[model samples]
Target: MQETLRRMQKKRAAGEGGFTLVELLVVVVIIGVLVAIAVPMYLNYRKGAANKSAESDVRAAVSAVEQFYTENGNKYPDDVVTPGAVGVKVTFKLGAATDGQQVATLSPGNTLVYKQLTTGTYRICGMNEDGKVVYKYESAVGGSVKKTSDANLGDCIGAAAPA
Candidate 1:
């Protein structure tokens, strides 16, 4: 029996060995665990990036609106429509009839039915949502492009000064 065992050991050492099923299973399980952890983390990171992008888009829109306001002597164009070239867009309707809101007419006014484009001109407003100013941006030209502040879109706008 001892001789037989010695011969078996020699065979095993001479490249006659193979991995056991249990060992192979362990390696597979370890890889699966790593994948499970890594996939969700990557997904979460992507979502955060999207939200940041949207916030940025809003800021850019705000700056554009301010620029329009300043340059045209408080005359915000009533319909700053989105150009065809624009991919992403954010549309912002001028605020309601309060808080010094300009009424739209033949000339420039505080209230505008305008659409914000992600590519070209855009607008963002700090809407009075239940006291806190919620930043929302609407794309003037709408299509496959995403402009809303969410996990899907990171910071869409430029690092513009808020209005």
Candidate 2:
């Protein structure tokens, strides 16, 4: 028994007790597979988040425009303006609230446009950081917000124009 224990100790000291190359390779392959699966899911989650943010911005803008119209004798603002407040990077072509027109403040990397389709109808379109999706809020469409994918900035205005 003593001799067997000594032989076993010697084998361990000779670096013969750890994982084999095949075992290590298997672990590495498993990790790679997990990473491959996780990366795309993470990227998809980020894209969905960005799209939701754009939609939120569009909704807020629609609320502000509707408020402005209601408060200012039922007329939509012709232009949007940035308030230049700290931590507010958004700019609007819609005029300032002080000018009897209120505009929504948006997150950074977002672009918003206000279109007065008619005297009583308007559309607010917003795009997020990715710029691949556009969120639109049209007053004439039952005030529902809609999302359009694979869209360009120009499409936000021209493609959705009311005939």
Candidate 3:
């Protein structure tokens, strides 16, 4: 029994008592499976976060426009000025900018497109950094921010909200 114990201790000292190949492979496979499940979930969460950020930007633009309207005789600004004190980057699509227009600052990659639909109505569309998610706020419909189907800003007009 003494000899057997000594032999066992010698084997452990030689690193012969470590995990077998099969045990190590099983652990690696389990880790791979966990990663496979976690990666897609993490990506989806990131996408949702980006969309929410764009929506927040659109809401900020709406607030700035509303403020301008309230302070300036209930008239909306002809075009949003860039690098304003509040909100994200804005691109006016209606026409040339007029003097004394309210400014809306822009972030590096995100963009907000503003258009005066009519004299008393306006629309603002915001795009995420990657330009994949778009959110729009239209005063004519319900003054609620909603996701838009259109991706590009060529027209700067977003589709109507789903019923």
- In the range 10-116, model 2's lDDT, one tens digit per residue, is 99999889889999999999999999999999999978887787788888888787777778776678844222223456745355547675657687667777777
| lDDT to native, each model | 0.44, 0.71, 0.67
| Candidate 3 TM-score, C-alpha based | 0.72
Instruction: Give stretches of model 1 more than 4 Å off.
Output: 1-13, 79-134, 137-163
Pick by TM-score: which candidate is best? 2
lDDT of candidate 1 at residue 6, scale 0 to 100: 98
For model 2, the run of ten residues with the poorest summed lDDT: 79-88
Ranking by lDDT: 2, 3, 1
Q: On a 0 to 100 scale, what is the lDDT of residue 89 in model 2?
A: 69
Q: TM-score for model 2?
A: 0.77
Could you estimate the TM-score for every candidate? 0.45, 0.77, 0.72
Candidate 3 per-residue lDDT, tens place, 86-108, comes to 33444433222452355444443
- Specify the highest-lDDT model's number: 2
